[model samples]
Target: MKKIGVFTSGGDSPGMNACIRAVVRACIYHGLEVYGIKYGYDGMIKGEIIKMQSHSVSNIVQRGGTILKSARSTEFRTKEGRQKAYDQLKKHGIEGLVAIGGDGTFTGAKIFSEEFDIPVIGCPGTIDNDIYGTDFTIGFDTAVNTALESIDKIRDTAASHDRIFFVEVMGRDSGYIAIQCGIGGGAEIVMVPETETTIADVIKKLDTGLRKTKTSSIVVVAEGDEEGNAAEVMAKVKAENPKNEYKVTTLGHIQRGGNPTATDRILGSRCGIAAVEGLMAGQRNCMAGVMNDQIVYTPFDDCISKSKPINQDYLKMMNILSI
Candidate 1:
């Protein structure tokens, strides 16, 4: 039987463990020996490999983070490092590899597959959900929900004190989490990187809302929002309305770590199993994504080159609801 290897690279996400479990179990169920790589590309370079069995992955479907761990290794950028990883693959007779990560992780997998003829299949696992091929990545749902809950909690305090609360959510380039939570939690203002939010725009929106009836406001800001940091933006707003009162809370790394939500668990499992099936079918340099409620394998090159834009239709719906 051919041996298959799986690893999670880049930042840790809530549903990574679920993806790992799904990949391992899927491979083993199909009579393929499964090997787990620890610490992402760093482990592959250092040959930190472990064999995985059904018992090894038991009850991990609901867990958070990756069992194999992850890292951003500069060494993996070098040809020598990749060569070492390829050599390790040869030594272990791992003919196929399933890599779970964002775009960077897929870049490495693409190179390894091309250079050594080792089949590699990638699964979109980032909470950012910025990957092109997939409509939704594994951990995005859970992250959005987590942000929503935090915003809800913050709203309680804002209402009681008749204050404005600025809640910062994690999203470097993409505002998927911020947008979802903003709409879900009934935020008064949302600052996203996709569209630069000006101080005037915020004032106008909040003034409209304030004139209506609400005594307080909740503003959801993506970490990459324009006009400097979210704290600074909030400060500027506070300056305009000193009596408005406002507090800034950065969710930071907390959004990245948590047990996979129900949606994430199910999504990760389906994506993982689909990845193994794709590789077993001799597919290489492809990413597994969910589209139209079905798993579709798209070429890695297409996935990397394409841009996944935010759903403006949903954004418009959110704008209506916010009013």
Candidate 2:
């Protein structure tokens, strides 16, 4: 391909700028021209395409969020909108594409490639870490670490006041962040969407801790938990035990900001380079992911159709260690 396009869609996450930097440099290193598609598919239809040079991406590897920016385009889901996007690509002489984002981004790329006979490679860039192909998606480490740091600070106050704290972390449909951060933060209890959780179970755990004279306790709840959000869960727990002081802290967009961790930077860089190499190798409609410390390509259908299950062993460990 003489010229290729790259863009980030869906929610923004840390390490995306690093990925964009890697894609620009890798394409340039291979003597290929790169075009930046601002605001993802929406921009593609609007013809918001710009030429990218190595200098355009300089000093962006350490930045948070995406330099190209991102947006969800309802128009892109329709046949006419996709045709406009494809025409825009033809106008810019873009032969291949590199898409960065979560499941929705890949789904759109998969359909567009098949319809237009274009080669497209995907990079998992969501903080949710729910993609099936990779062990961990880009920005997951940074987000988990961010939540863990906040939980640590909350613990300090919980101990001082001798109270119970309900800390909520983001993970729309997955418990990867809540499970990992709960264990890392030494939480007394953790509620995830993958498993059923009840307020009675929470009160029981707290009652046991109180009997042992535990000065403080923390329960980490995933936002998508079956029982409800952190606030709803806290309300139920408080109703049962009116005498105990309770507080709720939701780590909302904070987890999606800040500089990426070393692991995330490395992962994003590797995936970005692999995406360009995959397109050059005549591979299309696939995602570049790191598995077992090696780069691997997975079909977009498999990556999005299947669900990535959380490790039950970690849940078992959490139970054993909490006691």
> How many steric clashes between backbone atoms does each model show?
0, 0
* Cα lDDT, all candidates: 0.88, 0.94
Local accuracy of candidate 2 as per-residue lDDT tens digits, 152-249: 99999999999899999998799999999988999999999998878899999999999999989999999999889899999999888888999999
In the range 212-260, model 1's lDDT, one tens digit per residue, is 9989998888888877567988889878867677789999888888899
What ranges in model 1 sit over 4 Å off? none
By TM-score, the best candidate is 2
lDDT: worst 10-residue window of model 2:
58-67
Compared with the true structure, model 1 gives a TM-score of: 0.97
